[model samples]
Target: MQTFDQVIQSNIALIQKVVDFDAKNDQLLPLDFTAANTELTDEILDDTDLFSDWVNEKLAKNNASYGIGGYNEHRTIYSRSTHFDTEEEPRRLHLGIDIWGPAGTPIYNFYDATVQSFAFNDNLGDYGATIILTYDIDGFKFNALYGHLSLASLNGLEEGKFIPAATKIAELGAKEENGSWPPHLHFQLIKDMGGLKGDYPGVCKFSEREKYLANCPDPDLILKVTFS
Candidate 1:
């Protein structure tokens, strides 16, 4: 069987760029989450609300619609826990691409799929409202995890539900509902769920990078967004 990366690469063109992101024209702004980005702003990163405000400001000032990129990025923000194991290496390697935009932004499925499962993680620094969509392409089954969506996104969602390609499955959640962070969509491609549900590790320990990367490949293969 081909790896998820192999399959995605072979089907690259078929995978649509879900978010309105184009780094070439500055439609997207790359964020350096390793620090508070205090080089340009004096805002503090410890405060999730204020930090999110700053993120939105960057997009607005740059005239960009979204803040994109961060696959396999070693982010310091994961220290918040709901997604990390602080007791260990602090899992700072971000495994997905985040599309930071206004709350209520629509989230779509890249390919036709079924709702394998969904839930509200809700823990601080967690996925908050989450959804997992499963796909079976030629017997190669995989899933996509969408995190930090509006609580209402789950209103009528049901297990085994069929969602057509590019269907608006959920809406971006505000900090109040999206795990207390700025409004954004955490989109991750998973070859294996690790027996997880609604939530999976969006970040991993440095030592486990190889294993995790093998299972959680780059989401951009589907989003097709150009990163700066």
Candidate 2:
């Protein structure tokens, strides 16, 4: 059986920043929009549509990429808010590892793989532009998904394109190109999603945690980060 340990190593400098950010800002700090400007707070509450639009516009203006780590229950790493479809679900159970940085950050192919699928899931709450790559590792076949990417990455890209490990497959997109929030890369690994294509559930109900978790393991296994 192939393990992620046999795969790629992470960038140490980037990992340090993630660790440092959590330490300095209190990983459990509430997503306090109240601390922000009145205008911004009103926009977030009163006009979600306009607020989302503004976020998208800002992403286009500033090219950003992120390397934010995903949720860590033991460490108290949590999402600023909950948007799960159900109350029975884990409030902040993360479905993927977030590399939070800025848009346009170069995303490398973890290993030699062929593009299996790609799509522009443009919805209010969805992955803006996503790509899925499949490959073999130590005799085990697996898939790597790159979500919230720049639209340009999808242009001229087609299924079956051979992507070598560490190849710059795409750039982290601005909030607009990405589902509009912060610039970050949503990296996920899937064992099997059944017949699902062009769309996969990145978040799930806590009641179904075990099943979803077994299907999606910690991406840090491949990222090579020492989670605290």
Candidate 3:
């Protein structure tokens, strides 16, 4: 059996349909949650509204449609309560690629898949409205997680139903509905969900980077936005 990463890389055309990647009109933005920026300090990162405004301004300035990045990123923004564990090392390494865009922006299925599960994880600084889709390519089975979506996105969705490739599945959620963070889609591919439903860890501890990254490979194999 081909490895999950190999499966995606070998068939980039099928996986590339998850988002509209127009190199000409669509500009890719890389977000920095670390303290490298003199202006974006820890206090500002803690404030979602301010951070969202800052991000939006940059998008506007660049005339970009999305603010992307976060795969394997050592982010400081996880200092928020919901992302950190008191008894263990903080989960700072992000395992997903975040596409920042306006609320209600439509998200499409890259391939024919079923709605494995969906839920509203209303935690502070967490994936609020989430969806997990299962895919079977050849004999390899993998999953994808769409996080920070509108609560209503889960309405009427059932497991074992087919969602065609490029089908408009859900819209991005507003900050009020998306766990009080800036509107964005947290897209993650999982080799195995480890028997979980409706959610999976998008962030992991820096110490266990090797294991987490192996399970969650670079999403760009599918996203194909190396431009970010």
Candidate 4:
């Protein structure tokens, strides 16, 4: 079995930012609820879309990287519904690590990779703006996907653009452009997504956890940083 530590030693700083923070941070604070059993109301979840719009509007206003949703926080802080559909379903098991921060925060390439593809997902509950990078490490070819980015990030970029390690590929988008929620980055490692382009499932059902988990290992392996 490969450890996440072994796989992600090359990029530790970026990894730690995602893993080492309480979801209730002052800047990217989680919602305040009274009881543990507090169910997310439709209004709260709807704020996600409103937030996404606000992010986009702000980006248009000031042009920044602090938008919401990514691999760092998982799904808990985002208030997204629809856990993987299956028997014995795990409620909102996160498939990616979310980088919770303000919109327009700079996002860097963890390693050398080529621009695989990108798109504006545009659905109400979608990534809004997304990009994918493909690279090979020690004969292991794999991909990294950056979801919920500013529309400007896609400007002048195309497939096969050679992105160097630590290159600023894009900025974290605001909620408006990042599927309408708080600003964050949804980072995921994919082994095989069956040739899907510009989009892939970052969340999966509990019944399929074993299979999905194997295909998608902990991204922290490449990030090489711990939250705690």
Candidate 5:
């Protein structure tokens, strides 16, 4: 018996482009949002405008089109919003890959899937407009989540909508629409949704890292974008 990830790896060639990542025209830059970065100061994180400016500056400095990364990353940037706060502990560990780019950057369906769910998580530091698609490969079923998407992406979306492979499903949302973060697409692969609809925990408490990480696999498996 093969695991869900094993099935995905075996059929990697079938996955489609989720974003337009051109090697010649687009430079993929890896961004660090963890505590160790030291570059993300209090001023930047405290203000959404400043934070957006900082992201743009970094990409411009590196001459990159997209600032990417954040899978399984234990970050401290969540401190800016109480949305992730809990009595036990803050969910500071990221469970998805974030591709920072300009708002409205197009996003495509990576597989032939049915729209499992969609919603507007309007809380501050939330995913804002989010979409989840269910896919079947080699008889194994799973879900791919596209978060921080423009509210327009949800315009005509409905449950069980069939989207062909490589279809333009959504676009990146602006700071005001993407939970007040710098423009980026939060992509995650989930083996099981645990009966949730339209949303799941993209960030987890550090203490329960193992349990959450086990359910959420590395999104790079599908993204296939190399970084510095």
Candidate 6:
């Protein structure tokens, strides 16, 4: 049997666009949140408005429609919330690709799926409103998580509902609702949910990086979004 990532790689053409990747008007700009990025000070990270302004400024400077990155990144921004804190280590390794964009931006399914679960993970620095959809490809099953969404997106969702490829599923939430952070869609793919529902660890401690990363592969295999 081929691995989950391998199956996705083989069927890449079938994975639909979650964003308007081919739009002539939209541009993608890469953003960095690693410890090495000295620009993001505690003062800015602590304030959602300031952090959002910082993100938008970057996009504006580049004349881009969205700010993107953060797959397997050791982000310093998590320090702003205790939600990621543990006794042994803080969860700094990002397990998903973050697409920074305006609130209410529509998110689409990349594959035909059944709605597995949905929830409002309202914790600070959390996923906010989240949705998980199950997919099967070449007899291999997996789940894709759409996080930091507007609560309104969950208004009419039903578990087991069939959502077609490229169907609009959710919209990005505002800073006040989206984990109190800047607006962004946290997209992750999980080979195994480990019995979680609606929410999964989008970040992990450095100590268990390999374990979590194995279960959650790079979303770009399907997204195919390149930052140039």
By TM-score, highest first, what's the ranking?
5, 6, 3, 1, 4, 2
| Local lDDT at 74 for model 2 | 20
Cα-based TM-score, every candidate: 0.89, 0.68, 0.93, 0.70, 0.97, 0.96
lDDT, ranked from best to worst: 5, 6, 3, 1, 4, 2
Stretches > 4 Å off in candidate 6: 23-25
lDDT of candidate 4 vs native?
Answer: 0.64
Error of 1 at 172 (Å): 0.4
List per-prediction Cα lDDT, in the order shown: 0.81, 0.60, 0.83, 0.64, 0.91, 0.90
Worst lDDT window (10 residues) for model 6? Answer: 219-228
Instruction: Summarize candidate 2's per-residue lDDT along 1-228 as a digit string, tens digits.
Output: 435544433222322121122344322211212223244554364343565454445434443222334532221222323333454544445577766554676778766788888999876446789998887765566676888889998887788888776677788887677765566677788878576766677766656678877888777766544244
lDDT, residue 33, candidate 5: 85
* Candidate 2 displacement at residue 170 in angstroms: 0.7
| lDDT tens digits, residue span 1-228, model 5 | 998768878988898899897777879888988989998998889999999999999999999989986798999999999999999888999999999999999999998999999999998999999999999998988898999999999999899999999999999998778899988999999989999999999999999999998999888888877452
Q: At residue 59, what lDDT does model 5 achieve?
A: 93
The better candidate by lDDT, 1 or 5, is: 5
